[model samples]
Target: MKFATALLLIISYIAVASAHMAMLWPTPRGGFGTKQYNGRIHAFIGYKDNVWKVRFPCGGYAPGPITKMKAGQTINVRFYASGMRASDIKKQPVLTKSTKQFHQARHGGGMCEFSLSYDGGKTFHLIGRYTNTCPDAYFKWPVKIPSNVPSCTHDKCLFVWSWTANILPQYYMNCADIRLEGSKDGKLPSQSIQIVDFKNRKMNVKELGDGIKHRASTGPTKKEISGNLSGNIPKALKKA
Candidate 1:
């Protein structure tokens, strides 16, 4: 009789523990989310489905592929106040100094060196080097062209670069345009690289090549573009 009673107690304890764990750790809660506070924004990192949440205030969220995250993997949530604009919120700038830069060197119509800067152009850092054997020789977002040491005339060129920022913005709200530029002088141009900022429900496409464009809309007011590039790039680029 005593043995049966003890067994029942053990099973009861296990059942209670399982139920408690489930209530405390729900699945979708393991990912990432953002919030605003005290004239600044913050980011949180923890199991969207577990029992840990650390808040780090900064500019925006860059959701990554959830399928790539496995159990026990280390995740980082960072926040920066310098990336925010005046119209984002009624708050002061977090960082007094803000900047970012990217540079690429080409050889044989391909990228030979890549670097970037963020500290008001005071310093630069090497991000990568490239050649035919590199795995990212064909990735096409930040266009890569390969040709000569100072000339990009080759049909197959590669470009490499880094992205560094002294501080991230507080929020990326009301972004109206994005632009990119290429040159024959073998030097990186100084200008804003146009990107579609989705929050304000707006689209900004700057002239790059002769045949590049974009259009945007929502519900029944969607827009379209006619160029070599098709499909929705911004729709697939949202951070989780």
Candidate 2:
């Protein structure tokens, strides 16, 4: 009887933990729960030292397989902010409410960027860019896979989603495992940097607003597909 009581108390405490956002489409929390879509949020892409998360390639490694899609493919990517159901993102205040206070000081609106990796999780080129305003529930983003993509038989190319927080100085990065079976228009970029931003630098929220600086090297939009993101591919990777 005592053990049962302790267990209940522990569960209650866990239920009050700080709430955060998660990816719903490539369903991570696909397991089972009232607040869980399928399973726990990005079980593989865990939090970083500062409570944020890893960048592209998600700490330079592949997490787990959710699903696979073809290249040059147009798909609607979905997101689940907090709680188990899609509607929970709208009622985020409920999950964020703790005993002492309500964590309603911020909104989930921010910048979402998608990128595709050709050579495993080593490097990635931008795919699509999404911007949202506060007091909005914009979750789905349309994306087109690069028609000219390489195939990965044993290994997996990465589908990366990076969210730059508008509410805080931190950001979250997650990776999806996918195997592409197709040809390439040309070679993938070989010489790109790890992104020009607050990475490895001191905490500067004001300068890192939105956390992303759209560069000429990326094609984060639909129309930009015809044109490549990085200038030189083989060269870029060589340097990388």
Candidate 3:
């Protein structure tokens, strides 16, 4: 019995380590109820693996609740990095502290995009993009809706969150269902995001780094907050 229990423990740890980030707010389809572990309020909606993420759009989730949002408004979207709720994690392991706990892996913070798809997941229009220091400690992001985005009350609107890891050849995506209230202008974005291809294309590490360097500016300082990080630690990211 003891040997069997040990095997179970090993399996559990491996499951956690393999899984990555997922959306927490606005409620994606299937309503954050993945087959794996649940987060603070709901289970994470990330794909089981990198291949699973790229193989399907919106993590292959069905439509859930519809968030009625207005155009040109900035809303804070929440995420669970590494399938563990960021709120329940520490920057480092507990050997350095008295408390015993797990830490979320940042993966060196990569480029993230918040795109809108009026026609399901067919095509996505780039609404907001962030580089360098995305998915910070809290894993919550501020995304602004473009005033030119047309309302989607008549049909369904898919709000997608895509991230390309800078250090690893990993890509994560989560999509939410939203019903947009028309803006004063009531126009659509002139161009769609060309770079975000839904094909089974995974960007190599060199490509990810090049994209970051190309768009590099006086962006947020890179914070080394991986669970495996040792030595000096930076300031805790302010809560969202």
Question: Number of the top candidate by lDDT?
Answer: 3
> In model 2, what lDDT does residue 58 have?
54
Residue 71, candidate 2: how far off, in angstroms? 1.6
CA error at residue 183 for candidate 3, angstroms: 3.0
lDDT string for model 2 (1-240, tens) is: 653553354344335433344454443222112222222232223334333333334533334654577765765665543323334433432323234322221233455556766566567776665543211123245566656666655555667666555545545455666766657554443333334235563342311122222111111234322223331111111110
TM-score per candidate, chains pooled: 0.15, 0.55, 0.62
- The whole-model C-alpha lDDT of candidate 3 against the native structure comes to 0.52
User: Which of the two, 1 or 2, has more TM-score?
Assistant: 2
**Residue 80 CA error for candidate 1 (Å)?**
22
When sorted by TM-score, best at the front, the candidate numbers are: 3, 2, 1
The order of the candidates by lDDT, greatest first, is 3, 2, 1
Provide the clashing-pair count of each candidate structure. 32, 16, 0
Model 3 misplaced stretches (Cα beyond 4 Å): 1-17, 31-54, 83-102, 137-139, 194-240
What is each predicted model's overall lDDT from 0 to 1?
0.20, 0.43, 0.52
